[model samples]
Target chain A: MPAALHALKDFSDIHINLVGNQALIEAELASKSFDKNRLSITHAEQVVDMDELPSKALRNKRQSSMRLAVNLVKDDVAQACVSAGNTGALMAISKFVLKTIPGIDRPAICTSMPTMKGHVHVLDLGANVGSEGESLAQFAVMGSVLAKAIDGNPKPRIGLLNIGEEEIKGHQRIKDANSLLKLIDINYIGYVEGDDIYKGNVDVVSCDGFDGNIALKASEGVAKMIGFYLKAAFNRNLFTKFIGLLSYPVLKAFKEKVDPRRYNGASFLGLRKIVIKSHGGADAFSFFHAIAEARLEVQKNVPALIAQEVATLLTPQVIEATHNEI
Target chain B: MPAALHALKDFSDIHINLVGNQALIEAELASKSFDKNRLSITHAEQVVDMDELPSKALRNKRQSSMRLAVNLVKDDVAQACVSAGNTGALMAISKFVLKTIPGIDRPAICTSMPTMKGHVHVLDLGANVGSEGESLAQFAVMGSVLAKAIDGNPKPRIGLLNIGEEEIKGHQRIKDANSLLKLIDINYIGYVEGDDIYKGNVDVVSCDGFDGNIALKASEGVAKMIGFYLKAAFNRNLFTKFIGLLSYPVLKAFKEKVDPRRYNGASFLGLRKIVIKSHGGADAFSFFHAIAEARLEVQKNVPALIAQEVATLLTPQVIEATHNEI
Candidate 1:
């Protein structure tokens, strides 16, 4: 609430709708200062438990904060919605209420990753499990459209994440997807191994949700381990601790550069309306980043752009031509 | 050549058989110092390209240096073999020459990863691509055996890598493998996510080669990205540069803690004989780590231990009983 109120104060042109349980939110809101006309709270009857199954959430919790939040977008009261709720539940409710873009088969969970060059967006980060060639092809189109729309990259390099870069490597599904990618309208880089995601040469890296999720989580884990190691080393002894104190500003700057909060929001790509999923464990700063991302999504109109691109690219004729070229 | 020669000197009690093209190696070795008795050279007719297909190496490069090195182990002239050559060719040739442990299905690339508590061993790190439930189950058993033999952990906490911790989560294969893991005679922790690998809660994390390879490489990429970010931050201005210099010792200590070299030396586990794989890009310190790993393998007799475990664990009756339990 503090971070959102702070950010909302700065984003004077943008208004906020605090949608959640009414009594709980009103009690919390009483102590906060805001532009009365700019911010308002809406009542929600229920909360989505972090561990609740998506099916249960979808079936029973129709008036959940998650669902109500999405409903705001659907009802044209909001351009976008951001939540640090359960992913499966958020995905289910968002898909159920907002629906997917016309040509999009299934939505993909994409987030920005800080890389050596600058950054790259990776998609299907555990959104569509067991992606086949067609869905993967859709993911590519959605990712390409996203890169073009959000980053303003006219010709973004899109790569398929795989075990090995060789066409002969990986499983049948990826191989089929590879052939399809080669014949696509986008600048499809053949195939990228894991390191390529951080190399920052490509604009978007797409993979099966399972692989993408593992890679994303593994990267986070490794970064966390590095931080832990650095802290331990800095506090080892008096001399090191002195050095650490002297270098505190530089260390803080470095930490800020790689903080996960900067890349906090993940787009639920393929949704007809913009919906962002924040990390479940996000703090005030991170959640503000999520809000900033939602603001970016509305500014960019990423979903509408994807729908426009997919209309031309996802036709039966175009798919057939791609197959014939392969 | 310099790195090898430098590392060779430090490994005084351990002998190294340098196998490569006769003239090139001879010219390179002339200036390097070593304990003459502990170092020897063997000429091989061919070298494996980094891109050479494993099949081509196996069929046509019979006298390749890679083959010659493995042959030394087969002929009992060496206790173990260490190669920083092409992984596929090394795996193919080693499997052909030494074969697998009696009850082992295939050899897996197992390596230790630095974690919060200490380090944990992860297996099928690009060795067994697209593994089935049975193969994954076997990988668990092999990993369990490795921890007991190599680390002297009486019972290791072995976990199957998955997108989520719930048994009801992940794909069918992982779910099937989980049931099998439970029935087996090892400390099989239920599904562990990517972050769990670094939490140091589990001693062994087993995954399909595709996911395992991605997780491994993604971790490396993230670490590299962090280093890049740190360097970029430290070099941003004069004040930051001064701080970086003052903190040099502590920074160096931090670097050493997570240095890739310290975690080098992946074991080609499941082979009948011990075969260690140095990273293809390994330097003196890293290659030496691989040599140290080989020494440890010889001391622990990892393959023999795994064979014994598999003997009791993989009998038809036992497998059938496990299937029945599942």
Candidate 2:
């Protein structure tokens, strides 16, 4: 928190409103110097425990820190909200407070996946499991619009994530979604397998939350495993230790480029307002990255862009085409 | 092919039967030196294409090399079989030919997940997607039996792969499977997440084929991505390039330890006979690893062990308990 606050000093135009227990936040800020006008705090009555069920949290913690932060976005006091809270609870409150964008059926979690070329957007990473064809199509368009708005890449190559790339492969939902996508305006590549996520060829990868969540987390697990093995290998003997010392700079550069913190923000796309989710276990550096990401989305007006794209998506031509294809 | 053949020379007691197009197999083996008496070949009329649909290949290609290899095992000429072919076709034909072990409901694809401690077995990588609760429980028993037999752990720690560790966290399939696991005699440690697959604390991680396939492929993608970044970083400048040269040995050792080839074989468990599924794109070294893995499973009689454990798992008391819990 201190690191994030200190780094915010350079962003002269951005104002931050901290919502939490008033005294604790104030005490943490006491030792730091800042532009007092740019910093403010809102008192919240409680904090939602990470393990609490989303329904229970929604019913019991109306004045909780998470809810209060989201309310700022709702009241237009803030253009965007950022939370590193319980994902389900945060998602529930964000959807309840801000609602979905016009023509959007459900909000999807979209995050940047680091790849060889750069990064591509993937969704919905645990927001909606066992999703139907219609919902998945919505995610594809929402993700495509996000890429256009945020990455300035129009006609992003959108792919349906599947077990195989063949036309007849995968369960019915993907095949149904494939038919719907072909009728839409977005650049719909038929299907891509898991390895395509990092290939940098496809710009958007869409799948149900069950597969998406596992793909995201499993990728992280493998990265960490490789890092551990690399470290262990380098520490084996005096010669290897010397080699590690010599290669420290190269390794550090490599780590920075691939670090998850560089891609900290996960957008709750399809919502009326932008809500960026920082990893729950994120540090001050990662939180700062999340704020920076949220700032970018605000500048681009991502929600309005999605709402506009979806309006076009629902026009008679595309809708009739979708109907015919389905 | 040459490397695997060279490695097989030391294991002289084990004979090798190359099954494929006669001309192609002979041409490839002409330059390789092995004990001629120990090597033989079986000519097949057709080869199953990698992209062919499983049902199509099963129906159209009766004399395909895949069918002939499995036929050898059925004819008692071989104790086990290995294939680096289309997984769907392989599973379909293997099930058609060998059938499932008594007390086993279905065959699962089990592969070793490289972890910090060494490796742990993860099951149903892509065999039975959208599995029921009963099948999931059966996977647990079969996986535990294989772990005990192959890894020599009397009581292998088995966990249901899930998005969360909490009892109420995942879908009903996982919750139902959790209840069934508790009632069964396996060492069921409740739920584990994607990271737990690499944690090395648990010996067996069980999941439906959907999540399991994504997780496995996603992990591989991450490793490849990291390797790419590492190479790019080291080649950025002369100083880093020099460091890269110095660190080459250390890096090679690290890569060897974490290489997917070291953990290549995937077992099609629950079949009456041992059948290993090598990664379709695996090279000679990786195919050798698959053959080596098959040898271990054959020595352990993994299927019979699964049948015996499942015999206990299906006892009237356990079956009644399972019925009541779900």
For each candidate, what's the DockQ? 0.63, 0.58
Residue pairs clashing in model 1 are none
In model 2, which regions exceed 4 Å deviation?
A165-168, A315-326, B165-168, B315-320
Model 2, A231-289: lDDT tens digits are: 99999999999998888889999998899988998999999998999998988888888
Residue B166 in candidate 2 has what lDDT? 33
Instruction: Residues A65-166, candidate 1: write the lDDT tens digits.
Output: 899999999999999998999899999899999999887889999999888877899989887768887778788888888778778889989999887623
Structure candidate 2, residue pairs in collision = none
Ten-residue stretch with the least lDDT total in model 1 chain A: A163-172
Clashes found in each candidate (C-alpha, N, C closer than 3 A): 0, 0
Model 1, span B1-326: residue lDDT tens: 66566666666667778888878888887876667787788999999888898888889998999999999999999889989988888999999999998777888899999998888999988877678777788888889988887788999999999996222367777877887777778899888888889988999998988889899988988999899988878898998899888888888989988888988999998898988888888888898788888988888888888888888876777667767765
Model 1 CA deviation exceeding 4 Å by range: A165-168, A322-326, B1-13, B165-168, B322-326
Scored by lDDT, model 2 comes in at: 0.85
